[model samples]
Target: MHDASCRAGLARHGIMISLKRRIADRFHTSRLARSSVVVLLVMLLCLATWATDRRSLHLQLLTYAGSLGFIANSVPVVLLFFMVLVVSRRVIFTSLIVSALMGAVYRINAIKLETLQQPIAFSDVYFLRQVNASVIHLLSHYLSARIFLFAVVSLVILGGMYFWERPLLNLKRLSRIVSALLLALVAFGLYRGVSPARKLYDRNVLRIAPWAPAASELHAGLLGTLVYQAIESSTALREPVDNAAITRLARLEVPDAGAPSPVASQKPDIIVIQSESYFDPSTLAGIDDTSRLLPVLARARLAGSVGQMRVPTFGGGTLRTEFETLTSVPLAAFPKIEFPYLQIHDKTMPSLVRVLKTQGYLAYAVHPNDANFWNRERTFQSMGFDAFYSRKDFPADAPEDGWAIADSSFTEKMEQLLDRESRPVFIMGISMEGHGPYLENPVLDKAMRDSIPVPSTWPENAAKEYRNYAYHIHHADHELGRLWDYLERRKRPYILVFYGDHLPGFSKVYTAAGGFDDHQPASTQMVPWVMVSNLGLKMPGQPIYSWMTGGTILCSFAGQGNDYYAMIQKAQRHQAERRMASLDRETLEGIESLSRLYLRGEAMPGNVKESARQSFCAATGVTNP
Candidate 1:
C-alpha cells in the first residue's frame, strides 16, 4: 500500500511539470505577450524623458492631466519602433534597437550639460553626417570610454535577442508593402503638422523655453523639446530677410575718431590669438594668486588694455566668439543661429579678413584641431580668409599636451608662418591646448600641478580640475609671453590681440567653490582679453564684447574702417559707457538684420541709396554723422 501511494505522488508531480511547460511555451509564442512588451517599453521610454535629466517626473506629469507632453515625447520613439519592427519582423529586437538609440542620445545630452553647462542643441545632430577621424578624436576628449563598452554590450545583447527570438510577424509581400507605405504617409503627415501632435508641438503649447534647454527639457520632456526645436529650426531658417531693418542699420552714422592710421608708414602684421577655454582663475571667489599659473599674462596685462570681455556663449561654442570677432557682428543679432558656421552658408561674407584683404593684407587662420569640426574649412573661406591651416595642415609629430595639440607647438607654427610672410599678414591663431574635461588630464606632473592652488574647502574633483586647467593655461601663458617677446624683438611694428574664446567649463569647480566676488552667475561671467602693440597702442581697460574685438583691432591698426566696422566702434564706446544697457532693442534688431544680409553675401553697409538712408535716419530720430 505504501509503494502504491508513493507512485501516485510521483505521477502527480510529473503532470504538474507538463502543465508548467505548456504555459511557458504559450507565453513565448503569444502575440499578446509581444504587444505587452512593446507597451511596457513605451511607458519606460516616456518615464526616461525626464528621468534621464534627473528632473521631477511628478512635476512634469502635473503640468497637464495625463500630460500631452508624454504623448509628444512618445511620438518619435513609437514611430522609430514601428519602422524598425517592420524591418526586423521581431518586436523585442526592434525595441532593443530603439532603446539603444535613445539611450545614446540621453547619454550625450547629459555629457553636454555637464561639460558645456548647456543641453545638446539641434545643430549638434549634424554630427551624424559629419563623422570622421577628427570628429571621433573630439568625441574621445569629450565623451567617456564607457560609451564603447555600452555599445559592445548592447550589440551582444541584440545578437542574442536576434538568434533566440523568432520573427513575430509573417506578412505577405503586398501586406509588407502596404504597411511600409502607410508608415511613410504617417511620418510625413506628422512632420507637416497634419497631426494634432505636430500642430501642438509647433505652437509650443507647453511654452518650453527655447533658450534655456535644461529647464525646457525638464518641463516639457527631452524628446518633446527636441521635436519642438526641430519644428522651430525648420521655420526659423526660412524666415524672410528684414530689408527695412537692414536698411536702417546700413544707414546708421559711424563716428570717426580721426585717429592717425598706424599704417601711415607701414602696415603692421596683426596677430590675433583666440585661446580656447582661457580665463584667469584668480578672478574667481576665494582665489587671489594666479601669478604662478599665469605669470606672463599677469605682467602683460599691466602693459596692455586687459579686462573682462563679454562673449556670447558660456563654456563651448568657440566659433560664436570667433564669428563675432571676425565679423564685428554680435551673435545676439542672429538669435536663431546656435552654430553660426553650420547655419550661415555663404560663399563670401563680410569680415575683418575681407577688410584686411582689400588693403593688400594676406589673411590666414591656424587651428591645430579639425578644420572641419565647426565647418571652419567652409566658413573660413566664406569669411574671406585667404588660407586656413587645420589639423591636417599641422605637423604629424606636433607636441601634444593632454589630448590637444600643445599651445607651444601652435605658437611655433604661427612663428613659422610669420617668418615666411613677405606681405602684412592677419594671422588668426585659435589654440586648442586649454580645451577641457580637465579632471582626466595627466600632462602636468605632480610637482607642477601642486604649484597651482585652489581653495582648501573645495572638493577633490574641483581642485584637481582647477589644477589641470591651470596647468594648461600656464603653458598657454608662457607661449603668450614668448609670442609677445618674439614680436618685440622683430622691431617691425606689430599688433597683438590675445583673448579667451570663453571661460573653461569647470562645472564641478564652480558648484563647489562658487562664482565671482560680485556674485555673477556662470552665464554672465566674462573672460579676460588683452590687446598690445609695439606701436604704443592704448585703450581703456573697460569690459567689451567679442564683437568689438575685430573693430577695435581694425581701427587701432588702420585708424579707418568700413561703415559696418565704424558702427561697431561706436557701439563699443556706448557699451563701455552704458555697460550692459549699451544696445537697445531697435539697435540690436538693426544690427541683426544687417548681419543676416551680410551673411547672405550682399553688399556692405554703404551700398544703400542716400535718399533711403536719410529717410531711415529721419524716421528713427537719430542724428546723421
Candidate 2:
C-alpha cells in the first residue's frame, strides 16, 4: 500500500511539471502571446525611461503632458527595441537588452546630476571609451552595495530570458527576409527623423530650452532631449568662426602692453596649485570660524593678492577650471563642448605652459592621481608640459586622506621636484586630498573627526559629511602653509598661486545647515584664491575669473604673455575696472574665435601675430615652422 501511494505521488508530480512546460511552450511559440508580451514590455520600458527617477516624475509628466511630445520621446526608444527584436527575433531577450542599457544610462545621469548639479550631455557618452581600472575605482565610491546586487541579479535574469525565450520569427525564408528588411528600413528612417517623424517634434510637441539641459529634458523626455542635443551640437560645430568679432577684439590695445618684464637674470620659479574642492567654509551659514578652517589663507591675504575666484565648473569637472587657467580662455566661449579635454584634438596646443616655456621656464605638471583621467596624460603633453608626474610617479605607500592621496604627501612631492630641478620650473600641481564622497576617511582620526563642529540641528549624515569636508580642508590649509614656508625660505625668487577648483559636493550638508547669505547655491558661488611671492609683491585685492588669473599672474610678475594672453590680461583689467560686464555675448564669441585660432597654432591678426611671433622667436630661438 505504501509503494502504491508513492507511485501515485510521483505520477502526479510528473503531470504538474508537464502542464507548466506546455504553458511556457504555448506562451513562447504562439504569435499572439509573444506579440502581446513584447508590446507590454515595450510600454513598461518606455514609461520607466520617461520617468527616469522618482524625484522628477511630476515635473516630467507636467512638462511633456502625455501628448504628441510623449510619442515623440517614446518613438525612438520603441524603434530601438524593435530594431533589436528584428535582429534577434526574440522578444524577451531584446527587451532585456534595452532594459539593461537604459538602466545604466539613467543611473549614470542621476549620479552626475546629484554630484555636479548638471545634466548629462550627449558628449559624455565619449567617456565609455575611457573606462579602465582607475575609472572603475573612482566610480565605485558613488555606488552602493545594493546597486551592485541589483545589477548582478538583473544580469542573471537577462541571461535566463535569453535562453528561455524562443525566436518570434524564422528569417531563413526569402519572403520573411524581404519582410524584415522592409520593416527595418522603415524603422531606421523614422528613427533618424524622416519627414513623418520630424513632424512629431514640432513646437506644439517639443519646446527646447536653450543652454538648460534639465529644462529641455523636461520639455521633451530624456531620450528625446539627447536626440535634440545631438542635432544641435553637430549643427553648432559646423557654424563658421566669428572672424569679425575676433578682429575687433584683436585690434583693442592691451593695457600696459609695454610694461617692463622682470629681468631674465632673476626668473622666479612659478608654482600654481589647483586645490581640489577647496572653498571658504565661512561662505556657508552656521560656520563663523574662518581662521581655524583656513589659517594659511587668512595669513596669505595680508601679504598676497586675496580675492574670490569664479571657476568654470563645480563639484566634479576639474579639467574645466584647469583648462581655463592654463589656456586663459573662458569655457563660456565654447557652449557646445562640455568636456574640453576630450574635444581638444590639436596637439602642441597654446597654453600657459607654452607661454612660460617661451620665457625660459621648464613646465611640469604633477597630480597624485591617474594620469589618464580626463585624458590628462595625453592632453598635458599637448599643452606643452615638459613632463607629467602621475600616480605612478609618487610613492606606492603615499598617504591617502580618503580615496585620494593626501595633500600633505602631494606637497612634499612638489617640494622634492623643486629641490631636484635647478632650472626655472613652472609646476602645475593638482591635489586629490579634498575630493568628495567624504565619508569613512581613514586619514581623519575618529577623535579629530568627532571634535569637528557641525550644525546641531543637522541630521546625522549631514553632520558627518560636514565634519569630513572640514577635516580634509583643514589639512589642505596646513599644506598651503607648509608650501608657503618652503617658498619663503628658498634663496631664489618664487611665485605661488594657490586657489580652489570649486566648492565641495555637500548638497545635503548645505540644505541641513540652512540657506547661504548670498541666497545662491554653492554651485554658482566663487572660491577663494591667493597669490604670494617672496619678492614683496603688493597688489590690490580684486575678484577675478579663473581664466584671467593666469594672465594676471603673467603680467603682474613675469611680463605680458603672448599676444593672446596680453589680450586676456587687457580684458581682465577692463572687467576689473567695470569697463565691460563679465562674459558678455560678444566677449565670449570673440574669445572663442581667438582661442580657436591660437589652439590651431595660427595667429589672430597680421600685426598682433607678427609681434607675437617675433617675441616668441626671440625668447625661445625657435623659428616659425
RMSD of each: 4.9, 5.3
Q: Which regions in candidate 2 have their CA more than 4 angstroms from the true location?
A: 1-37, 53-57, 60-68, 172-205, 233-240, 247-261, 579-586, 606-625
lDDT value, residue 59 of candidate 1: 49
- Tens-digit lDDT track of model 1 for 1-625: 9999999999999999999888867866787976787788767765654455444332433344256666676688788878877777877788788878888887777787788877776667665556788777777877666778878989999999988877767777788778888888887766555657567785456668876775676656777777777666654544456777766655555433444334455688999999988888777888898777788778877665576688998888899999999988777755567877877776777788988888888999999988788788998998788899888888898889867899998999899999998888999999999887788876846788777767899989888888888888888888999999999888777888899998887768888777787788877888888777766666644677788787777656553456566555555554444555346666567667766655556665454433222211100111111
Report the C-alpha displacement of residue 137, candidate 2, in angstroms.
0.8
Cα lDDT, model 1, residue 284: 84
List model 2 lDDT by residue over 111-152, tens digit each.
887777777776776565678888888888888899999999
Cα lDDT of candidate 1 equals: 0.74
As a TM-score, model 2 comes out at 0.86
Clashes of each: 0, 0
Alpha carbon lDDT of residue 403, candidate 2? 74
